[model samples]
Target: MSNIVSVFAQKCADYDEKNVQSAIDSLFAQMGGVAAVVPQNAKVFVKVNLVREMSPEKCGTTHPEVAVAVCKRLLTVTPNVTVGDSCAGMYNKGMLASVYAKCGMTAIEDRTAARLNQNFETGVADVNGKVLGKCEFTSAFLDADVVVNVTKLKTHSFTGYSGAVKNLFGLIPGMVKVEMHSRFPDLTAFCDLLCDVCEFARPKTVLNVIDAVWGMEGDGPTNGKPKFIGHLLASADPYALDAVAVSLFGDPRSMPVLQAAMKRGLLQDDLANIRFDFERWKAKRIDNFDAPPIDHTDFFGNQLAWINRLAKKHMVKRVHPDKTCRGCGKCAMHCPAKAITLVKRKAKVDQRKCIHCYCCQELCPFDAVRFRTSLLYKLARRFSGKRSKNT
Candidate 1:
């Protein structure tokens, strides 16, 4: 298999139909064209990163312009292209419509011949991986003859980085994802399960594309600053794609999912094997890219059990639902551990039952979720003024 990851210079605001489509056309051409991955008259499912009901400009979800551009390209090879994703919450048609409308996915149907995935049906897949044996997935993804993962690049509060591999977590469908978090509270194990899901879906996945034209930098998947990266990336291998994607901001090994993937022999820490314009892309790297404190969370994977406990106790950010919480009950409904409760029309977290999974923080629509570091962690960061260099 070829280890090349294609990179293209583009922007979110480059909404000119010809410019966007040409970039995508060139991107697919770099990897032997859409016809190479997509077969004639085959069913194609374009899985986008619709994390929640966020607009395209937020950089939280996949931009519809990119999705439309990609779907238009895929439609040349197959007329049966559908676009959709299972956001965090209830998995129903009503929820789907709301998310689709808010996230601007409705544009795909208007702009291209592709149809939006109306299939809310969920089914269990026999994913017999080390961490995940069986799990629920959206049937739209499973029933497709070919799957194209179009993901948004973001920094995750819990997982450190969200790229091609982390985007597949959306396939699990709604609140079931919250349950998985409670089941595997440890960062390493959760990331292992992520690897398991990716491996299970890897066979049908033909191409992985990252929307780095604009990406979130701090406290993301949902809430963060949208920075202009002005680039897009594609690869047949998700691992290699992520390895290159993460390198744009930080070390790939620092990402929990990538670390777990390497341990499972799915990827390597070194990027020497991946074929890309290294020096050219390296020049585009953002030196001040705001990223999560991954080093603090790496303690969860330490061999010493006490160190793990210590990290869990103090190193991790504590979830605090502030006064801004609008009593929407979304966090309570989606809390995997059932640790969040609404009292007096306000959300309250039972810390004793809290798994530190940060689901409440991630899915809160009101942006009311606040994370407070412990005194010990603060002191440590104070002493260590700057994070160690990635090299």
Candidate 2:
């Protein structure tokens, strides 16, 4: 296999615009530039992770500055660049447009005369052979000749770390995300399904760029603290890019998505072959990034071979909520699964059906629904904690 990764870290120079752009230009030029990856006549689709309505300043979404810079550079090769994303909740094309405008991308469009598109088409990837059913995706992603994935580096509660691979999961449009969560209720199973989707969607993506200038710590993808890393990463291999990213800020062992990718042999666990100059772009390493407490050995450790089968049989039921859910469901829609329903201008869930997917908790705008488990589960958590301490 070809050594497909290169990293450049020039601390003092990176702060200089001439130096930074030159570095970026050199990297892209080495990787065959936009022309090599994106054909001159091809329609280039820039897929960004605009998961929530948070402004670029929040670090919940990809920074506009990064997107604009890349777009400006790409325009040197091609003008058919379209920036789009399937945002969560309501489709606010204007909101995204505003972000791009703030990031100076809109000026590039005005100056260079390009087009910006939003997610429109509905597509699906079959995951029938895996732990979950087929996942529905936006059509814009499926039809593009050149797909560039731009993701922000952040911590995720469920998957451990959110980077390029996890960002693509947002391609699943609208309420379909909730349905997929319901299918793979557990973390390991869900991560497997995510990797399956990545494998299926691999051909559609040509390049991956991670915005590491400023990232989120603690709870993220949303609801996390912002940590500035002052780094930007790019690669043809999403797995390698993510591997490097996780190493910079978080533990590899704790990331379900990374672990799952390793288990499937989709990525190399060792970073020895990857080529990057750490001295130029390396940020002051952050410590004590918080993530969910999960012992993979206890969860899927022993029967790694049988996780797919075991998940299908014993995976806990989880609850999911859509943007429309205001945490209020009419009495007629009130559900005990803690699966949210609208009742009398209020939203509630059927706690009985909740599988602990934390979907409702994640998507709830009002933060109404939360994980509510039995006392036994709580005690189990305490015992597991004490055991870890003693060990």
lDDT per residue as tens, model 2, 1-391: 4344654332222324455466567657777676776667667778777765566676777776566666767777777778777655434466556545544445445644456665566867675645656667777777777788888888765676778888777767745666676667667788887887777667777788888777877656566777777777788777778877777755554567877877776665665556765443235555555544442324333655465344333333233343455533421132223355565556655655555555444444353443323444334446534221101
How does candidate 1 fare on TM-score? Answer: 0.94
> Candidate 2: deviation at residue 209, Å?
0.7
TM-score of each: 0.94, 0.76
Q: Each prediction's Cα lDDT score?
A: 0.82, 0.62
lDDT of 1: 0.82
Model 2 lowest lDDT segment of ten:
328-337
> What is the Cα root-mean-square deviation between model 2 and the actual structure?
5.6
Clashes of 1: 0
**Candidate 2: stretches off by over 4 Å:** 1-4, 7-23, 29-32, 90-112, 125-135, 277-284, 292-300, 303-338, 342-349, 365-391
Judge candidate 1 at residue 381 and give its lDDT. 51
